[model samples]
Structure formats: C-alpha cells, structure tokens
Target chain A: MSNTPNRNRQLRSKLGRVRGLGSSHEGVHHWWAQRMSAMALLPLSLWFIFSLISLTGSDYVAFQSWVSEFGNSVFLVLFLVSMFHHAQLGLQVVIEDYVHSELWKMGLLLIVKYGSVLFAASGIFAVLKISLAG
Target chain B: MAEDDRPLSPHLQVYRPQITSVLSITHRATGVFLSLAAVMLTYWLASAAYGPDSFARAQAALESWFGRLILFGFTFSLFFHMCNGIRHLGWDLGWGFDLVKLRMTGVLVIISAFGLTVLSWVMAYSHVGKL
Candidate 1:
C-alpha cells in the first residue's frame, strides 16, 4: 500500500510525468503582480503626467530643479520601477500569445524582461543623479 | 503541422469585429506601444542628468514635428490603456460583467480616453502659451 502510486498520480502518462510540461504553479503570482503594479502605476502615472504638463515651457534648468526636489525624485523612481514592471508583464503576455514559434517567444520574452530592467535602472539612476548630485 | 483535421478554435479573423473586440485588441496594442515609448522617457531623463547640452539636444529632438506626433499618439495610448485597465479591474472583481454594462463601460472608456488626452494636451499647450 505504501509503495502503490495514488490513482490520481497514476493518471499522468509516463512522458507527461517526465516532461513536467504543465502549469508552472506561478501563474497566480504573475497575475497578482501585474495587477498590483498596475494599481500602483495608476496614481503614479497621473501625477507624473500632470507634473510634466506643469513643467512645460520650462528650460533644462527648470526640469532639473523639479527633479532635484526630494519628493519628485522619490515619486519618479517609484513611477519608473512600477511602469517597467507592469510593461514587462504586459509585453510577456502579448508575445506569448502572438508568437507561436518557441524560439521567437523565448527570445522576445528575454528581450522585454532585460530591456525593461535596464530602462528602469537607467531612469532611476538619472533621477537620483539629478536629485542628489545637484 | 498536426495530422489532425478538426474544427479549430475561433480566432480574430473568424469573428466579425465588434466594439468589445476592437477595444480589447486596442488595449493590447496600446500596451505594446507604451512599452516602446518608455525608451524615450528614459532618454529624456538620462539626457537631463548628463548636462544642459545633452538635455537641449533631447529637447530639440522631442520638440520636432515628428516627435510631437509621436508624443500625441503616446498620450492617447496611455490614456486609453489606463482607462481600459480600470474596466478590466472592475471585471476582475466580478462587476460589470453583463453585456449591457460591458458595452456601456467600453464606450465610456473610449470617450474618457479621448477627452483626457485632449484635455491634457490643451493644458500643456496653454501652459507654454503656444495655443
């Protein structure tokens, strides 16, 4: 009895068991993160847009001074991080849906993931540089 | 590639385009566009951080007619995505699932998206006294 495979466990084909090509069990996490980041982005994005509108007609110095404010720097960093995270998740779904070729899907996913992180980091670094160095 | 000959799942081409379907695809399309537009945002920030000369160059490029067009599109896409995203969130909570509600909200999303985009641009141009 102890050695017997459970009926449910025995239902899977041997190849299916070996391949493990089923739900990753992480889909819920992905879904939750996408929604959470999107929620964060709503307010952050609205604020950022209004701020940009306010900064219109302002010169480089004006923009720099705006970013140099402590609150502005913090919000900018938060916005960048959330925006990239949300964008990457959304793009991943898009590529996975449209790109049937396995190679293309994986390649595009990697590009979006890495590209998002790189851009987020660059934006954050720029914000910090302007805020702290000046 | 499969040897099977069976009816396939209905895809985009199979169904006649409707407002619901159009808005659904547009949500995704705008999302993809916004992802690419993020590069410009990063460029703007980095250039500003570097120095005034670089920032000026970035500004000039962004102020060009072509750049304004792209920016206008970006603005519209952002608002559309944001508005539709809220509708999605409502659906996630099991609200607004009825056909009537769905159509109403869908139209609302489109109207609000365009209204906000135009309003934002108006505010921007007015701020610069360019309108």
Candidate 2:
C-alpha cells in the first residue's frame, strides 16, 4: 500500500523479479532533445565559425548587410537555437555529475534549462526583428 | 569472470593520475567552458541585433586585452573540446579502442587542439586591421 515501495518496485532489474522501470517519458524527452540538439549543432557550429571569420573586419553597415541576407539570417537563427539547447544539455550533465545535493541539482537544472530557453528565444526574436525590419 | 558481473569495476579512488588523466580532466573543464561560452553567443546575437552602439560595445570588449585573453581561452577550449568529442564519437562508433591507439589518439587530440588554437589566433591577428 506504500507508494514509496511501489515506486521502487516499478524499477526492478531484469535479473530480479522485475526490471527497475526504465527512464520515464520525461527522461526520454530530455535525452532525445540532447541528441537532436547535438546533431543540429554540428553543421551550425561550422557555419558559425566560418561566419565569424568572414565578418572579422566588416563595419556596422557591412554586418547589417550580412544579417539582412535571407540565408545568413536563417542559418544564424538555427545556430543560435542549437547553441543554447546544446549548452543546456551539456550543463545539465555537468550539474548532475558534480552536484552532490539532489535538491540543489534539480533547482539548478530547472533554472539553467528554462533560463536558456528564454535567452535563446529572446535572441532569436531580436535577430528576426532586425533581419526582417531591414 | 564472475567479478565482471559487478556493475562498475575498480572505483575512482584506485586510479592514479597521469598526463592522459590531465588531458581527460581538461576535456571536461573545457566542455564546461564552452557551455558557458554558448550563453555569450546569445549575448552576441542580441547585441548585434540591437544596433550600432550595442554592437560596438560587444566588439570593443572583444578587442580589449582582457577580452582577447578570454577569447584566446575560449578558442583553445573550443578546439580541445571538439577534438576530444571527435575521439569520443570514434569510440561510439567502435573504433580506436586499443590501448596503444587510445594513448596515441589522446596525444593527437591535445596536439591538434593546440595547433588549431594557435592557427586561429594567427589568422585572427593577421586580420586585425579590419577590426
């Protein structure tokens, strides 16, 4: 009748009478997002590097023109999204690995994940506004 | 052989440190560095979008001595993390697991990271007139 024991019961291993219930749906969601964001980061990262190099000495007008380009803005948006999401995933793992206190770790993870999303969305909107307005 | 049935063998305390260990530690350190760096990326994008004054501030920071040092550290961390991640990807693909190969690859990643970092700085400096 105790929920605590029943919760443990759901996670039993195959060698035991039951396998411990594997990751919940939320766990799978985070894992999938991490992998997918990493995949997105791969090419976006390369593009970002090249873009930085290309824009090295360009003035404000030049940079404005660059961002105003349809393709440039599109890729830049992708890069921004992937960068923040990947950062969230990486930071979550680091926190989980090193943060010994469960409450602190959970709080930090939530702050990091939500903070990253908010920052990424704000950044993306700024970019779209600039690119579209121009 | 039954000992293999145990989940994980020989815990952390049993291991001694070495050059490879140092490099391994740096890989994770740089990873955290780059993760934080990604937040800076958001700032850069936002600043760029905010127009000239904001953008100039971002550029000014990057051009400052302290900023240059941080940028250099970031560049090194980026390359180190990338090389080490590729090594990991190789392992994930079931390649490069032999002892000799592992050591060689570890050294190779460190070397490549340094080489790429220096090369990037050289290119960046060579183009300093543009900034």
How much lDDT does each candidate structure score? 0.90, 0.77
| Model 2 lDDT per residue over B31-101, tens place | 78986677777787688788889999998997799988887898888888878877876776799888888
DockQ scores of the candidates: 0.62, 0.40
Alpha-carbon runs more than 4 Å astray in model 2: A1-35, B1-15, B129-131
User: Which residue runs of candidate 1 sit more than 4 Å off their true CA positions?
Assistant: A1-22, B1-10
Instruction: Compute each candidate's TM-score over C-alphas.
Output: 0.89, 0.80
Q: Chain B, TM-score, each prediction?
A: 0.91, 0.83
- Cα lDDT for residue A31, candidate 2: 61
lDDT of 1 by residue, B1-131 (tens): 66344433347887899989999999999999998778889989999999999999999998999988999999999999999999999999999999999999999999999999999999999999989
Q: Is the docking of candidate 2 incorrect, acceptable, medium or high quality?
A: acceptable
